[model samples]
Target chain A: MAGELALVADILSIISLIIGIFFLSLGMIGLLRLPDVYNRLHATTKVGTLGAFGVLLSIILQEGATPMGIKALTVALFILLTSPISGHMIARAAYRMGVKCCEGTCMDEYAGKRRK
Target chain B: MKRRLITYMALPVVWCLVSGYVTIGSLFLGLIFGMIVVEPFSKLYRLDEVVHPTGDWLAKIPKKIKYFYVLIKEIIKANIVVAKIVLSPTINIKPGIIAVPIRAKTNIGITGIANTITLTPGTLTVDISDDQSILYVHSIDATNPQGIRDSIRDDLEKYVLEAFE
Candidate 1:
């Protein structure tokens, strides 16, 4: 029974890691190909957190709720907590730095408030 | 009073997680340390008191769990959408910022909604007004900003209300 569980865990871990790496690779591609800092930030923040969560989840599944598994969960929690805040801060800073939104961008709500 | 004491319950729980120890000795030590640690900043945890409230916290626990379930679903959906866009042959994203007026009253609720919006794919919360009435959101595609606003109001803000309010 233990061996079977381990086999299931191994399979899950392998699949999760593959999918995680796949998402991370796309985030990297988005970083390179996106036209501006804001777009790249979107790609990296949203995609990267999920990718990291996937890897951490696989670790938890492999370890079966041990202390390390709990710790991994905590790390994942922190990732979710901090990633978006950091992304928001950077995006705000980019806008403050006068980073241009993409040419195709149709609106700017913060534009009027920029001068004041 | 009663609510603050209830808020104290989280301290040892966090201690157990961060210390990564479940033994009786560690738990006793964690209790001692948690008391010392949580005492100084009890006021900061006022948000917890407000969110948890005095009555029916145990019963309402399921709602918070449900919110997280929805959040995780949205997060995964977001990543899949972003992955598709990133891997597309030609990038055709039309990006812009739009103002979204929110109804979340508490600080925690507002922060929760903002973070949820920012974490979701294709949408990022760029700014909140001084009065905290509006969240300026940057979207990777803004052809229909009203749709984005409505989706956030319905999908994210309602859950935040469920969990925190």
Candidate 2:
């Protein structure tokens, strides 16, 4: 039974690793194919967070009772907290500099409301 | 008082577990050290209650799963397109920055939207408005900016609304 449990854990670890790889690759693709800066940011943020989660999950599975797993989780939590803030700051900077969207873009909610 | 005690106890326990040196004496020492360190800092920062309609934990799961699914599909599709572009030797990439109007009001909602954007790949969040109502992004490809905006508005903004708005 212990052997079976170990095998299950191994399988879970492998699965998580595969998922992480998939997310990383998808993030790369979004970097490549997305049509605009905002869209690309969207893709990266989602993939980066999920990719980190996948890696952390694999670590937890592989080192269930180890200090390494705890450290991995701590790293994941930090990523979760800071990544968004970084993204927001960057996006905010871009908007203030007057980046333009495509000509036919719909919904200009901020139109005529620029704080001069 | 409750939060302080919780923080004091939780920090040392977490430290001890993560450090992997499990001893009663060390645990006691760590607890004392944690109280010494954490107590003084706790007074410096005050915690504010930020209420959410969907709650924080549950809001992320479904949206994350959906994003994972969509991202995988997009990756496969993008890989083929990029392969073709690379093989063609024309280097037809058109990069540009675009400003997107944001609707989310709260700090959590706005941050969530921005992070969602950065996670995807080719785009980076460049800036947000002072009022937190606009997002600026830099994209490696800017052929269809509107489509990109709509997609974000549909996928991420909806989730942000559910999560924090």
Candidate 3:
């Protein structure tokens, strides 16, 4: 039974790793092709963060509930919390610096607004 | 008193979990360090102000769990949508910023909503209004700004209000 469980875990780990790498590569392509900082952030913050999270999850699954698994999970949780904040900071800075949105942009509700 | 005690206990467990050393001696050492850190700095750690002291904590746990479930599902859906957008040939996207008026009153609630919006499908929270009443959101698909605003107001904020607020 334990042997079968280990085989299942190994198969799951490979699948997770493939998914993680696929997203990570997509994020890289997005960062290169996206028109502006805000759009790039959409690529990195969501796609990149989830990719890293998937890789970490695979590690945990492969290692079971050991200390390494616990640490991987902790890092995954921290990545989820911190990645968006970094994206928010970059987007806010770019906006305040008067960086223009791309050509496809349809509207700007906070166009003339400045933080008080 | 209760807050201090909770902090004191939590800090050591955090220390052990972070350091990956779950032995007794390390825990005792962590306890000593927790006291040293939390004692003189008790005034700075005003968690009650940050997190409202809501009653019936037990009742909120189920709601919080459901919120997490929904969040994870949305994130997976978002990844697939973004992948499709990125993989498509022409890159037809209507991106822009829209001001979303928010109902979450507390800092935690507002932050939670913003982060949740950022993580989910094509929307990203850019900034908050000076009065804290609105969140400026950037959407990859801005052709229907009201759709984004209504979805945020209806779907996301409902779970946020229940869990965090």
Candidate 4:
């Protein structure tokens, strides 16, 4: 039973690692492909966090009783806390500098409302 | 002094349990090392609490769990799509950044939603409005921006509501 459980844990770890890497790669792709800075930021922040979490989760599962699991949990929590705040700061900085979206893009909800 | 002692002692206890080193001697050594090293560093680093979750929202736990289940399923599906794109030789990917209107109000909810978007494959959360009402997303393959926006509005919005609303 112990051996079986270890096997299951190993399989789960492998799966999680693959899933995490996959997300990270996609985020990188979005970063390169997106038309605008804001868009690229979106892809990177969202997908990067998830991918990192997945990889850490797999490590935790594999080392279920080790200090490694605690470390992984700490990293995950830190990423969760920081990534969004960074994204928010980036967007606010861009808007304050008057960065405009693509010409075809519709909806400028922030425009003309506060600008006198 | 007592709080400092407790905080200092926590890591060794965690280390002991994790390492399965239950002997009293080992525990004493680990506790001494942790207090000398880890406790000082922990106090040096500080995080400002910007948003706190109200315990009144505990009633939403069931709904949050259901939403989390759906999100996991979506994440798996997205991973498969991403893998396929990565392996293909054609590399027929069109990337675009699109602005998305966010409905989440509180800072915690907005941040949660943005993080969720970042966690998903093929989408990244780039920016959010100060009012927490808009999100800018970059997509790896954005041949259909409308479809992507709709997915965020519908699927992610549901989970965000459960988690933060």
Best by TM-score: 3
What's the residue-level lDDT of A98 in candidate 4? 77
TM-score of chain A of 1: 0.93
lDDT for position B143 in model 3? 91
Candidate 3, superposed: residue stretches over 4 Å from native: B22-26, B38-43, B46-52
List model 4 lDDT by residue over B1-165, tens digit each. Answer: 344555555767765655555568768877887767764565463322233446767888888788677766765665566556645665555665667888888767886787677656577665654556777675666778788889898888877887667
Give the lDDT of residue A21 in candidate 1.
87
Looking at chain B only, the TM-scores across the models are 0.83, 0.63, 0.86, 0.67
- For model 3, how big is the iRMS in angstroms? 0.9
lDDT of 2 by residue, B1-165 (tens): 345555656777766766665567768878888877765666564322232344466746776676556645543444344334334544455656667888888786777677666654445566666777778666556677887788778866775676545
**Residue-level lDDT tens digits of model 1 in B122-143:** 8998888888889999999899
The TM-score of predicted model 3 comes to 0.93
Instruction: Please state how well chain A of candidate 4 matches the true chain A, as a TM-score.
Output: 0.90
- Each candidate: RMSD to true structure? 2.8, 6.7, 2.1, 6.5
lDDT of 1 by residue, A13-77 (tens): 98998888888888899999999888898899998998898798898888766888888888898
DockQ of each: 0.74, 0.24, 0.79, 0.19
Error of 4 at B96 (Å): 2.9
- What's candidate 4's DockQ score? 0.19
Error of 1 at A19 (Å): 1.3
Error of 1 at B93 (Å): 1.0
TM-score of chain A for candidate 3? 0.96
